[model samples]
Target: MNSSEIIPSLEQSLITTDRDCIQLGSEEVATILVNLKSEEGEIIEEGGADVLIYAEGIEISETEDNKDGSYRAFISGAREINEARVGFRLDGKPSTKLITIRVQERCPEPFIDFERTQLIAEPPEILNDGKDYSTLLLQLYDREGRLLDDKTPVSLMANSGILSSTVFDAEQRLFTAFFRSRRVGEVGVYVSVRNVRYPVTIGEVRVVDPEPPEEEFSIIPYESHTMLQSSSLYLQAAGSPGIDSTKGIHLRWMLRGALGELHLPKGNLAEPNQTFNRSEDYVKIYRAKYSKVSFTLNLNRERPAVIDHANRLWIYRKEETREIYLYFRNAAKYDSLISNMSADINHSNFIALYHPELLEFECKDDLFLKLV
Candidate 1:
């Protein structure tokens, strides 16, 4: 075919629109439709043609294919006073015709989606350790249910806690921040949109001091021989603050065995007759004591070999005293460590003692028993 019969002229093509102009920040979007025709006024239905809508301060969706010779495009005014330029070109040809649409100035109706906008804490609660924290989330949207523009300024402030930052998420659709506190008090979080509107209260979170630990301790006999006064035992102790804490606490274990001289590690106590062990370190979040404590017991004499049933071991803690009797007669026959024993027995004339009951009730004991 000749060039005039093959190509369509831009002047002969028909351009139509649903509206002459679009109102900025309006919920209603504008649509534009274009139809191309050959020199003889015949509709050109050939595919692979270059058709596009270019605009400044406007958001455009992908051009929709009309199957016939016409195409449809959607445009939304993004700036108060801007314009959009619509054009089309056949394959391997430059754009021949251009259409301009005016954008009318308007104010957007912005509101917070209270259902979607929320403040959540990772742990729901925190300690005054200066290390624990909670995550803060906030989201804002316009009347059209679209996220506010990234350029929309925001202000986030915490009354009593530490705020990591007031920045938005990577996608710039949500605001994420971290809150922490070193003092025991309540934190009130507030947020502002565009820096001119009234602040929105996120909610309150509490920062509390670590709960004092309910310290527990006990003594257990590992092995013993009735013929010889020599015996071995394990001193186990454990306790933890309910929450995390930087200010460490103290746990002490003291002993008093009158029937025989104690043969064990040096004592930290002032009294010579009372040997003691102690732990003074901070406790981490959701964990037991900072250290595991277990000590061994052995009889010490100027000379070895002596049996006694009145042998006693005592524990001094929290200004309270507890005692246990160690018998040399049934040390081998009544193996307390192997049999079922009450865990709360602070005083017993036997060989071993376990607290909070035995973990391994069968022949296979726990690692703590194996270590003993």
Candidate 2:
């Protein structure tokens, strides 16, 4: 009985059958894993704040209960995000999601270490359409690479219908919804690690209807120069005569009363009127606005990047008393987080912003969700 004692003795002998609604075909999918304890089964609980999991999705009220079969499957992508692994598929395929992961309060230790839940579908926001801009993301990990100090909170839900609640900003792991633009159709977004003790859930889909109008020579992807977008939207492409060293001269910097374009934070672009410069506490120059040729951020560097972070502290930009000061996240950590127009500090914040979004069910793309 290896395989972790046969998966908790087959996930605690699952039973809720009329074959649990069998008769499935026409692309059937059944994955049962329910253990939220309390009806008798125990995972742990000793008090205050615990209803850890009671995930129920796949409920069909009263349509004759579908002739006693109970089923759900439909996806088309103006946006789509779904996942339940073990045999899950809506099209992308792998299947599993009779999904239940409950934990009511006290499981100090015994059995609770099963993590491998994933589903990430995003398109919630990232479209500029003002001469390029649709990729400026976020998400980095170590949620518990070992934790002795990690105030956890990773909850996101957009299971697309109308059941909403997602607005995280634990210092910019940003998830917004001032009423999510009052969506109407395709929707499903979920990601979890709430009620801690290593509880993780992932599933997503948010393809509503109201964003189609992009046609003027399209094609933009930083899908993976691989992760990094803490804040930026500067583009100024066109100017490749030499020096690429691997990809970095496609710049564009806009923000002079800016309005409809922002999310192009440092990816690969900077090399035309090359005379760039960088210097933590002061001295940054990128002069080169050759008629929309882009590169006009000469703030002369005095530290205003939300208090620099290479380990923090390096904010000092004094346009002669227009003051801003704080130094030592390595005094700008060897500057060069993307240069052009002469000046240097230690460039390597390598921007990519939350990469790994493939959830229809997965046949390829391996599944890697972290766009928060």
Candidate 3:
């Protein structure tokens, strides 16, 4: 036969050995069979031909010749889904008998769990004055009891009040709805997702009279005591005036000793204790001696006059009466050294030395002195 006649005489047919469609997530095999024939309808049994299969124009499988004029290729549905086209070639010829295979989702329906849904109205009540607002949180779950990941459209309807705005957070898988009402009554809310409507009774919000604000008070001690020359004093005050609290009462303490005038905020006074330290010359002499220390606790907001005294000494005495003596050597060096000390009184009243000779000091909750 001439080359033209021989090429035209060779024919190929492709057929699927399995179903035309595959179900997703199912481990089913799809097989294609290729047959080669002569013009006189005789099977070409002598094999050595290449056949390939493609899905969505991407090659997925290649055929193995059976040495009997028939070749086969297979694909697993579990690994691939969607529509695929199958084509076969014989002896380097162009592909023919192209067929399409389909892959479909196995589940026929999508559902959600209504019983697991949640609706919460923050503050539960809003003032009837119209300016105050309240927020509502809505949590939704799928039938598998998992948070819905997709942005499913949801609608909200109120029986009496109006929903001002709504926001959905995909990361938290919840929706926040802001609403307000000027009338004093109960506002019922209904929700709908994916065309499924829920009853208004799911969540109820109340609009009522605004309650009066309550008074609050607190006394916070200065974090640390400042050590100037020899005096260690800490300052404590009633609630942060004007900054944190609208109303605050200031207190002061009067010290009657060589340490000079020490102003302290009123709280409580624990007995002073003494300690001996031989490591530093500044505190070595006063070891184990109680320097005359006395204070009258008074609550008054009068700003004390700045007193600058020389050759004065101050001591910090804890509840156990452990004394930490501080004395000044050089103004610059003493200020630098004491600035690194800090103390925390744990909500207890502390006395701070306010002297022109001493700089500022702070104390932390855990009683430790660091100069700042």
Candidate 4:
């Protein structure tokens, strides 16, 4: 790595595209520019060894803009261009020389919409049959979420393909296969997803049988009971426009069996909903709320995980909605604080809501079962 003095120059930039031209949405070339000006308001024109420029998948367009009075060259096509510097000796030199600028063709468009994303199945439930081991046909998209390609592949796997598996398309999203129980028992499955457009994993999916992993537990009283199995509950979060990262009732719970899946309202999460930059205000990506939901499932220990926090366990119908709210908050350890908590329903799964902004512990308002 040789260090040298960078030449200061103006309009002596580099804007190169892998393709002289690219198909709309087709990620291909790059374009770059480097303009260095001195106090004289003149672009430095001296090229130096210390200053070098390079690029990938970027293009330099000739579209002149009347609005800015500069030839129109956007971070073309929404691809991100890394901001770089032209090194100068600065060894008491009256002026520094200039180098070149490298524009890039990196895709800046979010290929997957966090909100419009959906995990789909081919023949519905993907039941196992004969020599065939079900496959999930997937499709990916941009923020608008129009299918990027129609024939994306999704896979499934488990402990030796006996429990669960992973699915990946060119976009690299995952969906686990919950094989129809050969005989109806407790089955465990895990799912993780990815895509080229995403720097990290996009989503995760977890599946458990109609029964919670068996273990030891205690019980609480719900007075004057009628319809033991007639009551159920759910938690929902809204993903829409103009949702405040802070304030008011953002979530709703349902008494599934109580009133046949009717939603009841709840407040927002604790403060500090999301992060912000010095120039930009706070922006919210997701949020929601929850109320206690319960059910009953007969169990006798055909599983594991002895319930450690039964009173903290619950069950809810699975669905997405907007009328309700559920936001997220971050901690020092770098984990998310979803809504209040979950509780035990019956022999089935446990439930919790993600009211991202609030912490049940921080809120003054009591979190209780107030009939909606």
lDDT of 2 by residue, 1-372 (tens): 111121111221111111122222222222232221121221111122111112233322211111111222221111112321111222132223333222222212322223423333444442222121112122424434332112543333322222223344456554433213233343333333332222233333333444533521123444522134212234445456646533556555563211123222232353332222112223234766544322222333332444344433333333433333333332232243323321224222221111122212111212223221
Give per-residue CA lDDT, model 1, range 30-146, as digits (tens): 666665655444345543446654444466677776755566787774556777666655453545555566677743333556455666666667998767877776676655676
C-alpha RMSD values across all candidates: 23.1, 27.2, 28.9, 27.1
Candidate 2 accuracy as lDDT: 0.28
lDDT of 2 at 162: 21
Predicted structure 1: clash tally? 1
Across residues 264-356, which tens digit of lDDT does each residue of candidate 3 receive? 222233223211212221311122433554433121222222222243233444443344344443466434434453213210111232233
Instruction: Please list the residue runs of candidate 1 whose C-alpha ends up more than 4 Å from where it truly belongs after superposition.
Output: 1-110, 171-173, 216-372
- Report, for all candidates in order, the number of backbone clashes: 1, 61, 35, 57
Model 4's TM-score against the true structure: 0.18
Q: Ten-residue segment with the worst summed lDDT in candidate 3?
A: 342-351
- C-alpha local distance difference test of each model: 0.50, 0.28, 0.50, 0.30
lDDT of 1 at 118: 64
* Candidate 4, 23-119: lDDT as tens digits: 3444443332222322222223333323223322343354332221112133335235543322222223322322233434442443356465554
TM-score for all models, in order of appearance: 0.31, 0.16, 0.28, 0.18
Q: For candidate 1, give the lDDT.
A: 0.50
